[model samples]
Target: MDRRTACLHQANAFREKALADPEHHDQWIDEAIKWLERAMEASCRAVITMEGDDGSDAPAPAFETMAPHRRVIVRQ
Candidate 1:
């Protein structure tokens, strides 16, 4: 098979293995979703500069602005 197809097949096989472990299943799924979302976001960002240099090197959304959508979990 071609290199890309082979890589995809290997990734699918690994994902299947992860899904078989119930204890880690949900966490793995959440991480997979996050990675996919990041990939999509990066692709879109590549199409255009989101904003002109607004003076600061910080993210457009201030930390407070994103607080509402943030997820926090305290582990023992």
Candidate 2:
């Protein structure tokens, strides 16, 4: 399974554990939350991985070149 799927599975596992061990339910839920965060981060990385991106040192955007005093116009 991919990283995101794996993380999601771990989250579910922790959630089940929380139900089983009521005394440590808070700790188990906290573990589940951490796993969910990993899942989110994995999904975000997948989305950010664009086609033709070879991890090259790319040039900065035009706005960065402008003076700090100037207002930048961002185009969608």
Candidate 3:
């Protein structure tokens, strides 16, 4: 599986565990959020890398508009 997928799987696992165990709910939820964020960042980076800067394929506005060191904003 891809890194993104793996990360998402881990997040899901944590989420499930959190639902089952109330004692560690906050900790598991926090871990799940971290994994989900990692997955999202990796997915965004992959998409940016796939789109060449030479404009060979369609223009990637999201990737092109991003500045170095700027975090990508993802809306749920």
Stretches of model 2 off by over 4 angstroms after superposition: 47-76
- Candidate 1: list runs displaced more than 4 Å: 1-17, 47-76
lDDT of 3: 0.78
Better of 1 and 2 by TM-score: 2
Candidate 3 ranges with C-alpha deviation above 4 Å: 47-76
> Judged by TM-score relative to the true structure, which candidate is superior, 2 or 3?
2
TM-score for each candidate, following the candidate numbering: 0.38, 0.61, 0.60
From the highest lDDT down, the ranking of the candidates is: 3, 2, 1
Model 1 per-residue lDDT tens digits across residues 47-71: 1224437798766542222222333
lDDT of 3 by residue, 1-76 (tens): 9998999999999999999999999999999999998887766652333334785767655443433345556543
Better of 1 and 3 by lDDT: 3
lDDT of 1: 0.49
Q: Provide the lowest-lDDT 10-residue window in model 1.
A: 62-71
Candidate 1 residue-pair clash tally: 0
- Number of backbone collisions per candidate: 0, 0, 0
